[model samples]
Target: MISYVSRRLGTSLVLTVLVSMITFFLLSNSFDGVVRSILGTAATSATVQAKKAEMGMDRPVIVQYADWLFHAVRGDFGISYFTGQPVGTAVADHLTVTLSVVVTALLITTAISVVLGVLAASRGGVIDRLAQGASLFGYIVPNLLLAIGLVVVLAVELDWLPATGYTPFTENPGRWAASIVIPVIALTVGGVANLSAQIRGAMIGELRKDYVRTLRTRGLSPGSIVLRHALRNAAGPAFTVLSLEFIGMLGGALIIENVFALPGIGSYSFSAALQGDVPIIMGLSLFGVLFVVGVNLVVDVVNGWLNPKARIQ
Candidate 1:
């Protein structure tokens, strides 16, 4: 297991380096050329060169990537071009807000999926129909529409919560929770539907297995057989889906954040791209690459633990 984990980690590290190199060179050259072109020929060559040197544009592409990798290893992601703040500090601050929203959504979605999935699998007639209908509703509703509906219901009509903007958890935990609650729900509804579908399918398949039939013939209690034996085996596929969802939650939730006006790395990246803030965009991209790599590593370890056959393979 240890050796397998090490191999995965090594592969992830190498992939990250290659991705970083390609992204950095492309961005640096593009930005530098733009800057030089905009300044014109009469513009001070010395000043342009100085700015290039300052931004590490004057370095060889390999050297620049090496420097970036070294700083990234040290948890110093350099400084944001637009924000003028250290990239690490800026990302850390906004990331907390995003993390809170993502974690809350993940928990809520997990609860909804697991309970609904098990119930739907076990009680297949009208209950299964209703669950499938609800899942369809969730899957079809676009996130922007869901977010807007929540804002209208919770903020405009009822006035139960603030419309948007983030509150520091330390300053007022209650308001902080309230501010993000709607957004979390809006982000997680689709995830709940997808996960529930996967979980329900797995449970149904597990129920039809020979081992489960053997248990029934051996006079095992239905509840124990289903809850203890079936659930454990059924969860392997669901676990993989959920872990992949976790990684995607960080990078792919831009629309939800934009709808709610919650400042996060995704939103930050979006804004930076629009304005051609090359440094911030690059930093955000690098952050996402690392986040995905870390999540996949974790998922691999969990998968190995859940199925020993995976390790053997």
Candidate 2:
């Protein structure tokens, strides 16, 4: 298990480095454009040169990347070109908001998907059909559309939740939940649909295995056999689906954040890209790559725990 974890960590580290290098090079190649955007169209040639040199754009790409990576390892991402805020501070502020919605949605998705999936697999009649149908409907509907509909019904019409805005949980937990509910629902719908389907399929397959029959013959209760045995085996695939949903939620949060006018990394990154804020962009890019790598590592470890065979693989 230790060896397996080490290998996974090594792979994740390598992937993070490769992705950060590629992103740095791609952005560096466009340094002139970024500098121009920052300085404005009327800036003189010498002024641009001075600005570039000041920002270390005049340094070799590899040297700049090495320098950035060195600081980044110590959690110093420099200052945003546009906002003058430390990149790490800016990203962290927004990250909290994004994580609140995404993580809540993920927890809800997992619980609801598992219940629906297990029921559908075990019952296999009207319950199954309804679960499948709901899954299909969710899969068909785009998150943006659903978010709009939810805002109209729950926020605008019903006045039950806030349509747009965010409140820090530290400030008021009640308002925080109210502000985040719609966004979380929007993000969760598709995740629940996809993960529930995967879980149902896995559970069904696990139920049909010879071991299930043997367990039944030993007079184990149906609930015990399914919950303790079948579900455990089924969870391997479900975890994979859940991890993928987490990554998808991060991407989806970008649009959801804008629609709801929430402060999140997604919205911040979007504006940073538009303004050609190299420090902000580079910091966000590195964060995104590292976030994905870290999530994948967690998923691998969880999968290994669920299925010992996965550790060997």
Candidate 3:
């Protein structure tokens, strides 16, 4: 298990560095227009050149990347040209909100997918068909549509929730939870649609195995056999699908945040891109890459423990 974790950690670190380097390279190259965005079209060439030199953009690309990486490692991700605030501070400010929504969405998706998947697999007949059909429909709808529709029906029409906004849990837990219902549902529905079907398929395959019948023959309860035995075998593939979903929550949040008027890393990244704020864009990108990799590492450790045979692979 230790070796498995170390291996996964090493791989994750390498991927993070590669992503950082690629992001830095792409951003650095596009920075010719960045100075203009920062200084305006009215600025003279000499002034722009001076600004570049002052900002160290004139340095060798590798050197620039090294310095940026060093500062980023120390939580000093430079200043956003558009916001005039430290890049780290800007991202940090919004990270909590973004994470709150994503984690909530994930928890909802997991609980729902597991139950629906297991039920559909175990029950078969109409339940199985309904679960599959629901999954297909959920997977097909765009999240943007889901957000707008939920807001209109639940928030605007029925007055059941706020139409568009966010309040921190620290301010008011009820309001915060209320504020996120539409967004969480939007994310959860799609995830449940996709993940539950995968779990159902995995579970169905597991249920047919010889050991499942043996457990039944030994007088094991159907629930025990399914939950303790079948679910574990089914979990491996479901977990793989869910990992991609987890990574996607960050990217998905951008659209959901926009439609809901929520302030989050997604909104920040969109603003950064619009303004050509290279530092903020790079900072957010790097942070996202690290977050995805970190989540995958934890998943790997959990998978290793759940199925020790997975460690060798």
Q: lDDT per model, in order?
A: 0.82, 0.92, 0.89
Model 3 ranges off by over 4 Å: 306-309
Q: Per-residue alpha-carbon lDDT of model 2 for 1-313, expressed as tens digits?
A: 8999999989988988898889889888788888888889998888888999998899999999999999989989899877789998899999999999999999999999999999999999999999999899889999999999999999999999999999999999999999999999999889989999999999999999999999999999999998999998888788888899999999998899999999998898888888878889888988888888888899889888877988977
Deviation in angstroms for 64 in model 1? 2.0
Candidate 2 residue pairs that clash: none
Better of 1 and 2 by lDDT: 2
Could you tell which candidate, 1 or 3, scores higher by TM-score?
A: 3
Could you list the CA RMSD of all candidates, in the order they appear? 2.6, 1.5, 1.8
Q: Output the number of the TM-score-best candidate.
A: 2
Candidate number with the higher TM-score (1 or 2): 2
Task: Quote the lDDT for 53 in model 1.
Answer: 77
